[model samples]
Target: MSVSDFLAFTKKNKNISPKIRLYLIDKDKHYFINAGTLKNGFSPKLTIANNRDSVLSAFSKMAFLFDELIRLRIVGHSNESDSSELLYLLNLVPINRKIRTFLDWKVFGPEFTRDMSRLFEVRNDTVHCISLDEVTYHPKSKVSLSSMSGFKKFRTDFQKAWKTLLEIYVTEQEKLDFKKLSMG
Candidate 1:
């Protein structure tokens, strides 16, 4: 929806509490300096906030699954090793450290893991109030779809990595955890 329409809707909806006042900027002042769009080649949508939420949600899930794969593959090693043990060890290591350890081990080639790195970049960009996402205005705000530039490649990369992890790491379909997924 256009900024004007969004403003109209916000005013109409009594339940909607806006964090910031909604106003229209001069169309000329609206600009997006999106290097992520060039890098990921993903376009932003007209419905900015929903698109952002969806992308964030998908990336969050993939990042979580990636971390789980690390725990099961690196720490758990086998079904008999104990799920509690896997989670306990996982509790000790931060996600960044885990990814670095996985890379250091070279269990999977960088080709498969590059996206993992990108996930961090994208996540950092999203989480840490970086430009693009930070510069990005609220939905229905008078700005281009700026924050969404980093998300285009995230889902695809995550899916590919998750697929490879399943193919290589999964040992059982029924249980689907350290017990079934252990490399040992």
Candidate 2:
């Protein structure tokens, strides 16, 4: 099916959570996934807080999306080039090193994995602390606004980076025809 058709189908499923819905819609048109309908009684509540629970939840969601992309074959994995190590390189840099094992190297690359790791670091900083010392309001004017604190900056940056990465994944997907793959 076409990408738009897949997105339309996804939107029609009433069981999907609003957050996942927003995430799918916000993604670039190319990287859309046919997630199918959720089973009954599935509900995810995202509680906003400055705690490990909140951070972990967000990270988990991000990781899930990355895995889904790999499953869709939108990206390719890195080859070990050496079977002795049994090591696989990822197509995307991961926010956590642990995700490398989630898929074969042919689906996720090392560069992508590194970028993901950086994104996770930024996300973590945003979710855990608040400080007045790190943000500057006016870049050209060199006028620092006391009102914009570190937490505020982190939140803003995190959202932008998250959305951008989603878009990048989608755009990459558009270039490949998953139907050609035996698994797809």
Provide TM-scores for the models.
0.44, 0.42
Off by over 4 Å in 1: 1-50, 74-82, 130-132, 135-151, 171-184
lDDT for each residue of candidate 1 in 76-114, tens digit (9 for 90 to 100): 323333545765777777667766776777755665556
lDDT of each candidate versus the true structure = 0.42, 0.42
In the range 1-184, model 2's lDDT, one tens digit per residue, is 4445544554464443222211232222322222323332212323334444554566666665555455434223212232112223333444465445432443445654554555466445545546323323322233222343534443454455456546554665565432332122
Roughly what TM-score does model 2 have, to 2 decimal places?
Answer: 0.42
Best by TM-score: 1
Candidate 1 to truth, TM: 0.44
